[model samples]
Target chain A: MKLTTTKRLERLNERYANGDISRRSFLTLTAAAAAATGLSMPWMGRALAAVSEVRFDGWGGVVQEAIDKYAFQPYTAKSKVKVVQGTFGDENEIITKIKTSKPGDFQIVHSSGVNYYIKYVNGGFNSEINEANIPNMANVLTAMIEPFRKITPKLSAVPYDYGTTGIAYNNKVISPEEAKEKGANLLTDTKYAGKIGGYADMTTRVWYAALQTKQDPNSIQDMDAVWAKVRETRDLAKKFWSSGAELMDLLSRNEIVVTDAWSGRVAALQQQGQPIGYLDPAGSYAWMEDMLVLKGSPMAECEELINFMLDPATSIAVAEGQNYPPSLDPTKVKLTDKIAALPAFDPTGSMKSLTFADPLYWAKNEDAWTKQWDRVSKGA
Target chain B: MTKGWKLYDQRLAWILVAPVLLLLILLLLLPIAMMTVYTFFTFVTAGVESAVLTFDNWKEFLTDSYYHGFLWKTVRVGAITAVICAILGYFPAYFIWATTFRHKWLLLLLLIVPFWISFTIRTFSWIHILGEQGLINVVLIRLGVISEPLPMLYTEGAVIMGLLHFLLPYMILNVYVSLESIDRTLIAAARSMGCTSAQAFREVTLPLSMPGLGAGLLLCFVLAAGSYVTPQLLGGSRDALFGNLIYDTIMGQLNWPMGATLSIVLFVLLGAAAAAYSRYMGLSQIMKGLSA
Candidate 1:
C-alpha cells in the first residue's frame, strides 16, 4: 500500500515517541536516505553517531542511592551509557507504567516477585532475557534462579533481593521466647487480642494464616479457610497497618504488643533500644524483588544493565547498602564480618522457614479476598 | 432598546456557564460513561485482556453476600460520620458566626491549620499519640493512671476520630455561611417580643440554619463514604472500606473490570442518595446553605 505524506510522518512520530528509533538513530536513518539522495555532509556523520543512554526505574530514596553508587555510576563508567533514574512508590505503580506507557519508556524495572510473575509475564508486558547477553545470570545461585525459572521457564525476571514476613513485638510486654512459642497464633491469642496488629497486605497475611493452619500457600482453593482464620484473628487485632512508620508508632505507644513487621524495621527498632523483637514462625511468607525488561525495550542495552547488576560484587554492594539479601551467590564476594552478619545477607534459617508466596494464587483469589477483606475491615 | 439589553443578558449567562459545562462533560461525564462500559467487560486475569461485554462482574457483585455486607458497612459508616459532623460542626459554626471579635479569624485559621499538613503524616502522627509506647501511654503511666498502655491506634474508634478530623472543617464552613447570612435584627425582634433566648434560638436561628446543616451533613457523608486512607491506616483487618476494595481491585488485584464495576455501583448509590436528599430538601436550599 502506498502511504500519504501525513501517514508517513505519523508513522515516524510514533516510532520516535515509542523509542523504537532514538533521535540519533532517526537522524542516522534520515542521513543515510539523504546520502542516497546526494545530500551528505561530514558534520552529519558526526551528529549521526549513536548516543548510548539507559533508563532504569526503581523505588526511590536510599534504594536509588544504592543503585547510583553501585550499579548506575559503575555501569555508565564502563559502558559509556548514561543511566536515567525513574521512581515508583510501589509495585503497583511500576506495573501500571509497564501496562500503560510506551514499552521502551523503561529498559529495566525493580518489581516485587508477585508483580513480576502476575503483571509482567501474564500481561505479556515483559520479554524473555537473551541469556547470552546476561553472562552474570550464570553466576546467580541455582536455588535463587530456580524459583523464577519454574514459574516461567523462559525467565522473564532475575532475582534481586529476598525478605521474609515475620512477627515484631514490643519486648517489654511480650518476650521473644513467648512470641516464638506462640508463633502465628500470637495474633489470634486472647491474651494479646486487641493488642496485636499486622500489615494490611492480603497476600502476606493470607499466606501467614494458611501456613499457620498447615495449608499450602500456593493453593488458591485453600484461601477461604485462610480468610476465615484471618477474620477470626482480626476480631482480636487492634489494627492492621499499612506503613513502617505507623507500625513503629503503634509499637512505641503500646497500642500493639505484637505485630507482623518487616525484618529491617524490626532490626532498626531493636538497634534503637526499643524493646522490639522479630520472630520467624515455621511457615511464614517470603518475598523477592526482581528486575525484568519491558517487552519492547532496547534488548541489548537492557541485557547489559541486568548483567552488570547481577555481578557478585555489585549484588553484594547492593545487599550491604540496602540491608536486603542479594539473590546472587553470597560466597563469591568478600565482605566484612559486620556486614556478613546482617540478617538479610545471611538469611539462611529464615529462608527455609518461609513458604514462598505464589503470585498466581493471588491473581486468582484477589477479587473475592479484597471484597471480603473490605467487609471485615468495615465491621459489616 | 430594552429588548437588545435582555438579549445581551441571556447571551452573557450562557457565556458564563459554557466553559464549566464543557469541562464537566469532558472530565466527569465522559469518564463515567467509559467506566460504565468497562464494568460489563470481564478481565481474563490480572492485567490480562478484557472482552467486549459480559454481566459476570456485576453478577458476582450482586450475588455475593460479602459485597452486600461491604455496601451496608459503607452506608453505616457514612451515615454515622455525617450525623456526628453535623452535630459537632453546628455549635462551633454558630458560635463563629454569632461572635464579633478580633480573634475570630485567628480561631478560624486554627480550625483550618490541619489542612496545611499532608493527610498521611497526620494519620501517622496518631500512632505516636496512641500506641502503647506512644505519648499518651507514657504520660498516663508516668502519672500512675495506668500500668500498661491502652490499645488505641488501630481500632474502629481511631478511624472515626481521623474521619472527624478531616470532615469537621467542611461541616463547620458550610453551616457558618448559612448562620452568618441570618439577620441579627430578627433575633433582637424575637427577644424584644419577650421570647426567651433559648426560644428565640430554637424558633428563629435553628429553623433558618436547617438548609446549611443538611448541606454540611451531605458533604461529610459523601466524603466519608469515599475515604480510603483513614480506615486503611487506623482500622484493623476488618476495617477495610468500599474505597479500599476499589484500591485493592485496581492496584493490588489488577482487576480493572471489577474495580470499574465497583466504582460505577458506588457512583450510582451516591447519585441515588443525592437525588433522595434533593427530593426531601430542595437542591437550591443546599446550594444556598453551602454558599452561606
Candidate 2:
C-alpha cells in the first residue's frame, strides 16, 4: 500500500509541475504529504491567482496607456488575474484619495514623484516589499533606486523612470554657450525679460535658484533674502507654467525663449528639428517616477507586477512610449537612431548630469518653498 | 372647503414638488453646509484634514493684504466687464428692435449664432488676435505702422476684451427681449402728447426697459466676478482673481480649509448683492434675464 501511494503522489506532482492542474488542486493532492513533510510556505501562489484583481491607480492618458500595454498586459497574460486601473495623480489629488480610502482598496499606484508623494508613505498607505518576489529589482540601474531609497523607508518604492529638470532654450534665441554661461541664473538675468517662462512649482525651480547665488539649496531654513533673488526671476517671467505640457506648448509657439523644463520634453522637440536644446543648469536635479505597492496589498502579486515592469524589454517599451529613461541599463534595450538621439531615453547617459534630489530633505522645506513662491516670488 | 380636505391637498402639492425640493437640498444646501464646516477645520500638509475647529483660515484671509488685493481686483474686473457689456450690447439690441428690415430675424441670428460655438474656444481665439505675433500685430508690423508687436495679451485690456466678448450676447438678448416686449403704441402716445422722438424714448422706452437692463447688469456682474479662466489665460502677471486664489489654495497648496473660507466669503458677498438686487427690483425680472 505505501509503494502504490508513493507512485500515485509522484505522478500527481509531475502533472502539477507540467502545468496540467491548478495550484489549489496540487496543494489538496499534497495535503497528506505536506502533513507528513511540512511544506506550507508564503511564496506559493493560489489556485488561479492570489487576488481576484489588482487595482492600479496611476496617472491617466498616454502614460497609463503605456503602462497597461507594456507592463499590465504582459503580467495579466501570465498571472491570469484581472487588472482594474484607476487614474490618480497631481500630488494633492493622489494624497487626498489615499487618505480617504480604506486600507488595501488600491493594490498599486504609479507614484510620480517620491519627494512630493512621500507623505503617503508616512501615512502608512505603503509599507512592505519582499526582495525575494522581485528578483529583477537588482537588474535595474542602482542610480534609479538609490536616491529614493535614501529619503524613503528602505524599499518602500522602486523607481521606474527618471529625467533631469533644467533649462530648455530656443537655440534660435539663446545660444548654447549663452545658456551654459548663465546656467540656472539665466532666469534672473533680465536679458530674457518678458521671455522667460517660470515653473509654477518651485521644488525644481528653487534648487536651481539657490544654487545660482551659491546658497546650500539642501539646507535652506528660512529664505529671508532668497525672496529678493527669486523676485528677480519672477519679474523677468511673463507667465508661470502649470505643467510640462503647457511649458512645451509655449516653447512650440515661440511664446517663450528660455524656461526651466524637463529634459525629455526638450529632447522630443529637438528631435523634431524645433531648434531647442536642454542644458543641465549647475548640475541638474534628477526627478524619478516610482511604483509603490500599497499597504495590505497582496504582496506576492504586487511584487510580481513591479518586477515585470523592471524587465529589460518592458522597461525599454515604457521608455520609448513615455519619453522617460529606461530604468534598466541603456544597452539592455536596442534603440533606433531616432530614440538614441534623445538624451533622456538612455539610462546611463541621463545619469551623467542628473543627481538624485533628497526627497526627505526636500519634504521638510516643500511647504516653505511653496509659501515663499506664492507670497514673495509672485508678489502676492 | 373643509380643513381636513385642505390639509390633504397641501400634502399632495408638496408630494408633486418633492423631487425639485430634494434636489435643491442635496445639490445646493448640502455642499454649502459642507463648505461651511470645512472653513472651521484645520488643513495640514499632504491633504490632511484635522477635526480640530479653528477660525485660523478665516482670520488669515481677513488679515492678509494679499487677499485684500485679489478681492479688490475681482470687484473692479467684474464691475468694468459688466458696464462694458451693457454699453456694447444695447446698441445692437436697439438696432435690431428699431429696424424695419425684412431680415430682422437674420440680424438676431447673426448675434446668437456665434454663441453656438464654445465660449472657451471663443476666448482662446482672442489669443491669436491679440498675441505678440498675432494677426493684428503681424499686419501692423508688415504695414510698418509700428516698429514692434504691441504688448496686446496678458494685460487688463485682454481680460476685459475676453469677458466683454462672452457676456455681450447675454446682455444683447436681455435688452432685446425688453425692447420687443414694450408696446410701440405707448411711445407713439408720448410723441403725440407734444414730445420729440428723444423725449418719447426717455419718458416711455428707457424707463420701461429698465427691468431687462437691470437683470443683464446683475447677471454679467455675478458671472464676471466668479470667472477664473479668463484672467488666467488672458490677464497679465498681476491679474490674479478671487477664483484663482481659491483654486490655488485648494489644488496647488492643498489647503482646503483656506479654499473653503475664500469660497464662502465670495459666496456670501455675491449672495448679499444678488439678494439686494432681488429686493430692489423684482426677483422675476432678474430671473427673466437668465432664462432669456
Measured by lDDT, the strongest candidate is: 2
Candidate number 1, chain A TM-score: 0.77
Query: On a 0 to 1 TM-score scale, where does candidate 2 land against the true structure?
Result: 0.84
Segments of candidate 2 deviating more than 4 angstroms? A1-90, A93-109, A122-133, A146-156, A293-305, A329-353, B1-13, B101-115
lDDT, candidate 1, A18-133, per-residue tens: 34554555575665566666655443443355547877787665556777899889999998988888886557656766777876677778877753565677777777776766
Point out the worst 10-residue segment of candidate 1 chain B by lDDT: B283-292
* DockQ-based class of model 2: acceptable
- How would you encode candidate 2's per-residue C-alpha lDDT over B154-241 as one tens digit per residue? 7888998999988888888888888888999999999999999999989998889887888888888888999989987887657778
